[model samples]
Target: MSASAPTSFDKILIANRGEIACRVIRTARDLGYRTVAVFSDADRDALHVQLADEAVCIGEATASQSYLNMTAILDAARRTGANAVHPGYGFMSENAEFARACQAAGIVFIGPPVDAIHLMGSKRLSKIAMQDAGVPCIPGYEGEEQSDEQLLKEAKRIGLPLMIKASAGGGGRGMRVVTDASDIPEQLRSARSEAKNAFGSDELILERAVMRPRHVEIQVFGDTHGNVIHLGERDCSVQRRHQKVVEEAPSPAVDDALRARMGEAAVQAAKACDYVGAGTVEFLLDDKGDFFFLEMNTRLQVEHPVTELITGLDLVAWQIRVARGETLPLTQDQVQLNGHAMEVRLYAEDPAAGFMPQTGPVLAWQPASGEGVRIDHGLRAGYRVGSHYDPMLAKIIAWGDTREDARRRLIRAVEDTHLFGVTDNRRFLAAILRHPVFAEGAATTAFIGADFADDAGMHALAPQSHHWAIAAVLLSSQSPVTTRHWRNSGPHTQRLVLLQGDTRQTVSLAVSATAGPGVLDVTVGDQQHTVRLGASNQCIDNQSIEVDGVIRQPAWHRDGTQLWLDDAGQVFSISDVTHAPPATTAGAGTGQIRAPMDGAVLDVRCAEGDQVSKGQVMVLLEAMKIEHSLTSDVDGIVASVTVRNGDQVKGKQILLSITPDAPEA
Candidate 1:
């Protein structure tokens, strides 16, 4: 490969999955490079696999056996004659060893140098490097001594409300906030466990937690020729569980002076590690406008689309060029920030349920499309959402002339988007976009937990009287007798149960068969409506339902006795319980502990006869690369343990049984 060949890749193997993979493939394809997608068993039929020129199955559903398996990925690259490898964001994106392996295997790693990744991979080491480079860093201890006692002492010295973070962790894993001194030991244990599981390291660093700070990150780019530039900053303060839910470019709080200072600091941080390609230098912007270095992400971010939109530049394309030993495309002075851009991560989790990861078929997937709206997703209708990956389903980004314009466009775009069948955070994201705090650009790290922590964001869609009538007509249309005998009966009443969130409503429908096959006169409550089904405008398997003269293309799907509808923006799940079997008491409030979702049991904290207290963690379930502690609901003695560590269990499957303690005499 010549040094002048800036974009000289015949084929590139994407060593990741989901939307990021698809994003990279789109850029690679546009650059006239053949893309090879690697997938696990669960993602064999995923959008990324289908979009690539060729695809190879790396391993099983587990990330360790697939995306993160360095040996398997190298082998796949070799087998497919892939000349370059693109680790898109997650998995092995920042793994220095993986980059070294790629170099040893003679494949181009489209990222930073191995030395850079190694130095910045550890938060402690990176902080030291930044301090030495004269960058503003958070006041903390990043010593090599990492014993439990030392950590506790450091936590004390750092004062209350300190943070314990894994030295080699990112993406909010291996991180914990300790507001009380007594909780340090337990938080340390949990943080270390997660760190070891996530980054293969248990070493920790202590820092004083900056309260109510805004998370602002600068997008930096570098090349092998010693050129680096910052593309302004993005405010990612709208977060949940320490992970960013919404991100926007040209932070509302950052003025021109602040932007220059933060951008210069970010560029210095990048230069300290001799960084290359796309990287983000995150900072905690305090109330007084003082910013401290948080960490550096040495890979493309999931929210890269916002930067791309605002700058009108393709970051993936830049990564490819930089990997080929190219010079920087533009200098710092040449980099210009354009209009305001914002993005929201649409996740496959129920925000009302503590953001628990959900797995089910995507019955209907209709992404928003318009002039300013950009939807980056890797989902399709009928796509099965497994528990072995992140819960993020898609990202909706909108760009406009101003921040308010962008915010309004994004809210409308989110409302226009729809994803059915699985419990998702669409409504939750819409609520966030419309929240007063968010709209005012005053969202801090505690925005979600403080403002919309409960189901306030999940307000139920008020069911109109005509909606019930439409439901009745649709229900009756499903019956064979109603279609055959159009003008027979005067009116027939039917009862159906529909569940939305925690509220269950029994809807009574009186339909007249004389109205004809395509139309029905239905009475729901005291109101009556003439509902009609329009001519099937089949876009894939979805159809349009014309009710009372209004034509609505409702994205809908049916599976057995369940029907899901996405009318306008509200997603309604209707189930027919007319002839359903009586509810069984087999698992009714039994002290049996069930798995929260499909996951592999990482460890069982209690034995069969072990006595446990209420809220004591009995088992640790690992799913989507995150560990979930299954706690006991009541104080009891473990009666039976049915699952062992490493056992793969389905959602709601019994893992253990706890017999409640007998009343003390």
Candidate 2:
């Protein structure tokens, strides 16, 4: 690879989808380069495709047939006469073979060198390289012996509470935590299976788990001219399922001294592999200020916005410049860090339901915008979020003079933003930001487990009386026959049942003449409240609800009998089940098994006529890049199997059925 000659290209192809692809297009267009977007059949009409100069359909919705199809991506670029390809993270970003193929095809790969990607893509090899470079690292086994017996023997030496990580991938996929010695074998098998399914490699790497440590990483930029520098650090400790949900720049836990040391180590790691372009060196920072090298991500990260906000630099632009054989724009001494910045990922998932990935049409989307706020997304009102990709929908970033200021601004941003129809973690993100531990900058990797047990009060929370009243008034107002519902000379009342989650409440509403028009008295249970709306018949859009004496401006979306309300930051989904029949509760030990979401069957652990116990793992479903173990709710005999291995199943589709065992006499 020669860095002496500058290479220039007129067209650049983005080899990814969603926000990241849209993100790259913005930068490439700004730099006067024509952008080509490659899309799968599912994303033919996606936001990124519409934003690009041209788009090519690569394959079907499945990742293996589209986004991961290297030949198809390269073919799209070749057909469009694109001389450059920017793999916008994920997909083929860390794929060394893809990079090498691009180089062979005479197309500029706007990322790290192929060798750097190959060495850093593997956790096992990267750890060895970091150790050889004299960087601080945790004691672990990254041996070539990948046998179960060998891993089990190594686990005994490493003791309990070790981390089982995939050597070929990250993003919490193919990773497991083994806290008991006896569970090592199962964890090893699970990790290897996931590793192969996700990265096509089942190689395992064991690391001594660093309990309750801050996940701090340095953003390092390298150019073809042999120059590399760090742009400070980011604290990414607030995570769930080993995936980061919130990230902030200039870690509150790191002082100037600690930053300098970590920054130097990150630069060393980049240079060790002769890296060029954008990369991240992750570290595990302990309470004593000591840090250990984790691994290096060979491409742009999902949380790069916060770092860009603090540094006032476009890392994507830097990658393009470096691909053109440019030198570092700023030296180590010239680099500067500005005010604090924080970002939170908005995912289409139900935090109360084990953070399971959700899929549906985005009925509405109104991202918050104001001073110091930035929303990066590719969402529109009617775009359908599919199960073929990741669940992350968008990212909200805020910058402020201080960490607290950023936190407060972020909380407000989350409150103002609204996305209905599909469930999200917006409220959950707000909870983490407002938590005392996070407010004090004391949160670690265990923050979610420690502070958000049972989803941090999210699951247990039922709609308040005010919520019910507001919902009832809104429902009554939206009725087509508004004359009888909104205005009544005599005493006229209506009763309705609103269901939220498993909690059902019957609310009675009556027109109240005391507060002029659009006023109604609502009663839920024994509590009565005065609910005033802005208009008599207006139910959708922005509405004002003055419950009792308190007033709140809430955004609402009504689809048929289902209503979604975003009051401040707390979101509620209320269904008008008044005319609907009472729902029958499936027996506690029912043998009906259904798929939770649209996914592919990875394994069927039971067969027809097989006896199964309640809580036994019956099937493994893979959806949105995560494996879900479906268990039997009752002990029974398998009567039928509707899904086979590698079969695609829709949400709520029955995977199998079992005949319940005879009850005790």
Candidate 3:
């Protein structure tokens, strides 16, 4: 690779979607290149589509036909007369064959060489590269070990809390944490199964696990001509299930000396593979400050915004620049970082419900703003959140003069946010941002685990806040203060929403005819939560609405007197008691709840009702969405059976019920 600008390629094809696609297009446009966007059928009206100079529908709902389809992406590039192709992140971003295809078609692939991609793509192969580069690595069996006996010998060397990682894996998939030696065999089997299903490879790698370590990575850039520079480090220790939830720059943990060591290690690793363009060298830093090489990502990362904010560099633009034969404009000595930056991933999952992926239309949405807040979003309000790709909805990034300022600002940003529709985990993110431990920056990869012991901890705030918010909103159900219930000045009635866990109050409360619309004021105790409504809140062209300060589209439904609010894949039912039945016979129906969705049978309690206590776990269901336990609504006897073992039931379907007794039954 050389450091001279080649000066070619008039048009480039972006073979991805979501924020990454838009991210690449922004850089391409700045580089005087016409951009073409390849979108799936589900992304026809996506934000990226609107941003691209040209857009072509690549395939159906699933990624198999669109982003992952090599032929389709290459064909799009060829059809669009694009001389270069950018894979962005995920999908085929690191696929060696995909890169080679672009080269074969005479189009520049905006990544490392095919050989480097292939070598680093395999964890086993990368181990060899890292070893050759003198990078510190945990003792593991990257070599062939067929029998349990052979693997066990290596496991003892790696010690307990070992990891069973897939040779062909990234983004935390195809990996398992094995804590006990006795669990190794079964885990090996399951890990291999997951790897096969996910990456079409059962080739597994084993490595020692670091105890309570910070997940830090150095962002490095390289060129064809023996040149490379490190862009400091990013702290991604705050995570859940080995995936980063929040990320920041200039780690509160890593000082200058440690950052230098990591930066040098990262530079050497990149040079070992002769890497080019934007990439990351991940590391697992132990409690004792000792570090071990985790893996090298040969493409842009989702949390690149943090680095960009601190270094005042557009990583995507630099990637394009270096790919186009430009030297890294800044030298190693010139590379300096200022200020602190934090980024929170907004996912479409319910944190309380085990972070399961949710899908629906964005009924209302508005990204947080003011000061240093920026939102890298994929969908607009009203756009449907599909189940085809990742569940991440957006990246809400904020920069501040210091880490504490960033933390405080991010919390304020979230609190002011108001959203509904397509369920987003904004509130959960807000909770994490404001968490005492997180605020102190004493985080590790297992941070979420260290704190969120239960559903209440997951939210990190008083349950009454929601109650107050709902109460304020519900107040809208009553007429305005100026008009009495008997008077006709104010609107008589309004809409009261009931979800599985939360409630909302909406109304057409008017002060003047020209007032247009107002807000839903939710009151709890001494606090009042106001959510904007009507014209000022709507997106105009889309179904999404913006109330307070968050971006969300809540899932909603109505049945009889109960209105449900589905936010981020969680069904929170709030009672709409305006019309509930007055009274029932002694033993009729206590309305025993059942499984609301399909999931694995984890635990089961209670047989028939047998006069069980309220909120008692009746059964447990573990789905890809998350884990939830069904509880009894009231005391009664098991009345009917509609489902059994492994049966998948739709929401609201009666699985088993406890028919109330007539006092003597």
Candidate number achieving the greatest lDDT relative to the actual structure: 2
Residues 354-459, candidate 3, lDDT per residue (tens digit)? 6666666765565668998877877676687755577887788889999988888877666444445544677777767767778888878877787744435365
Q: Following a full C-alpha superposition, what root-mean-square deviation does model 3 have from the true structure?
A: 7.3
C-alpha lDDT of all candidate models, in order: 0.83, 0.89, 0.72
Off by over 4 Å in 3: 1-7, 454-665
> Which is superior by lDDT, 2 or 3?
2
Cα lDDT tens digits for candidate 2, 1-665: 34568888999999999999999999999999999999999898789999999999999999989999999999999999999999988899999999999999999999998899999988999999999999999888999998998998898898878999999988788899889888898999999998998778999999899899999999999888788899999999998878998999989999899999999999999999998999999999988888999999999999999999998999999999889888888999998898999999999998788789998888888999898999999988879888888999999999999998899999999889999988898988998898888899999999988876654535635677788888887776767645244555777788898899878899988888676666778889999899777763323366667899888888888888888888887789899999998687664467888988888899999999999999999999988878899999888899999989999889888889989899999
lDDT of 1 by residue, 1-665 (tens): 11334545689999999899999999999999999999999998899999999999999998878988999999999999999999998899999999999889889999988988988888999999999999999888999998888878888888978898999887788898888888889999999998998778999999999989999999999887778899889999998778899999989999999999999999999999888889999999999999999999999988888999889999999998888877878888888889999999988876656678888887778888898999999998878998899888889999999999999999888877877778877778878888888889999999977876654665445556665555554555555535345554565555666544444456665444655655666555566666667543223234666666777766665554566666655666776555667656545345678988899999999998998988889899988767789888878899999999899999999899989888799
TM-score of 2: 0.95
Clashing pairs in 2: none
Ranking of candidates on lDDT, top first: 2, 1, 3
Candidate 2: worst 10 consecutive residues by lDDT?
A: 535-544
Query: Could you give the candidate ranking by TM-score, starting with the highest?
Result: 2, 1, 3
